[model samples]
Target: MREDDWLAARFEENRDHLRAVAYRMLGSQQEAEDAVQESWIRLSRSDPASIDNLGGWLTTVVGRICLDMLRLRRSRPEQAVGEHSPVLADHEVPDPELEAVQADSVGLALLVVLETLTPAERLAFVLHDMFAMPFDDIAPIVGRSPAAARQLASRARRRVQGNPDIPEADSSRQREIVSAFLAASRSGDFEALLEMLDPEVVVRADEAVAARGAASLVRGAAAVAEHFSGRALAARLALVDGLAGAVWAHRGVPQVVFAFTISEGRIAEIEMLGDDDYLEQAELTIIEK
Candidate 1:
């Protein structure tokens, strides 16, 4: 094989791993794919023979790209979680790769918690904890000493494991409640939403959505029901991460995710994720009707 052909062949071997790392780091499928593509572009421009470990090189490159994107995201003020927008798909999604990602999606609750982490903290945690990258190797990517990187991961780990985003009920029941919530939402049935929510249900959204006058924190069953009534008509029943939730996909790309916190057959909390990048990074397992 020609040298270029040999190089391309080798890179293909690392595609899935690279995509997995990027998805965990960025939490968006499209962004992950973009990072992987950029890695290939970088490899194409470099002398592959000089690289001792192609996989490691590609991993770090994707990591760095994800880090930059995360930092940029942090710097920007984003819109609210659920809002009106023109349909981008403008009907159905039949992308096999997207379907595969959805089939074995990463946990939704975890991704929501991960978003709460800072860029450095996210990188450290995703690489060290999820991908099992050593802290020493991760240090250079986040521009931190190994010790600092370890600390970042440690902090992120604690938050992820103990946060409200981690639902404490049966997965199947959680899905049922989520499905009911979606049904209520699609039909704009306020009473149904109220029935599925606790008397003191809570709703949370990111600052980007809140900054645009969206409610970041909402409490009370009546109020939460009113907020969701007649919304999410475009969303489908899916597993957000491992938690039962709903996603609004345009054509095949997810535009929003409705994450829930359920307890005793009622939704205790609501997390509406509409940020474009965050939505893409989310792993959605569409449940069969």
Candidate 2:
């Protein structure tokens, strides 16, 4: 293989690992993939000969890229998918991180907790705790000393380890809740809708969807209830990304995806995906029961 081919091949070898780190850092598959791709781009443009331990180098690059992305996320209202306060005090979606080495995942609830962490804290925690990277290696990425990085990891670890028993996410219960929500929306049962939603429930819409005159971000139970109640008549139940969710489809083509973060038997947050690309990428499985 030629030099460029060799370089591309080497990066490909670390792609999965890079993507995993990014996912933990950013909590959105799309953004994680973007970070990995950006790393590849940077690799292609840099002096390949100067690099040693390509895996570590790529990891650091992705880490820096994700740090910047996480910082940007902090400044945004919509934030990253799955990166928000845990809606449920005791609920966890299937763990995605452990899917590689084990059959189970760390669950979406952990990701939500990680979102509460600052950019540096997240980087330090994910890299050191999740990937087993050393604090020394993590420091430069967050622009902190090794000791500071260790402290960041320690703080994050305490927060993460403190939540040991996130309630087992029950798909059956999820289906029922979503069904009730749909029923309430269709029948204009505002009270029922409010009951199903957490008081601080937040609903986020894609920019494209928001630009069309819909509210981009709706917060509070009353406001969120007012938006969904008497609406979503066209939506039907589906296993969005393998979790219980709802979708709005026309003639089998989905136009919208409603991803939920449920907790304590209430809808804590609803993330709306109206972007065509997001709809296309959604892994929607029609729920039969």
- Number of the top candidate by lDDT? 2
lDDT value for model 1: 0.75
Candidate 2 lDDT over residue span 1-289, tens digit each: 8999999898889888897788777766567779999999999999999997899999999999999988888888675454432222245454354244222334567776787788988899989988999977997888866645765786677678764232346777888899889899999999999989999999987665677677889999999999988998888889875567898877888877788888898999998777664465456787742
Question: What do the candidate models score in CA lDDT, each in turn?
Answer: 0.75, 0.79
Q: Which pairs clash in the backbone of model 2?
A: 88-263, 90-167, 95-105, 95-106, 95-107
Q: Candidate 2, residue 242: CA error in Å?
A: 39
* Candidate 2: stretches off by over 4 Å: 80-105, 163-289
- Per-candidate TM-score against the hidden true structure: 0.51, 0.50
Error of 1 at 191 (Å): 67
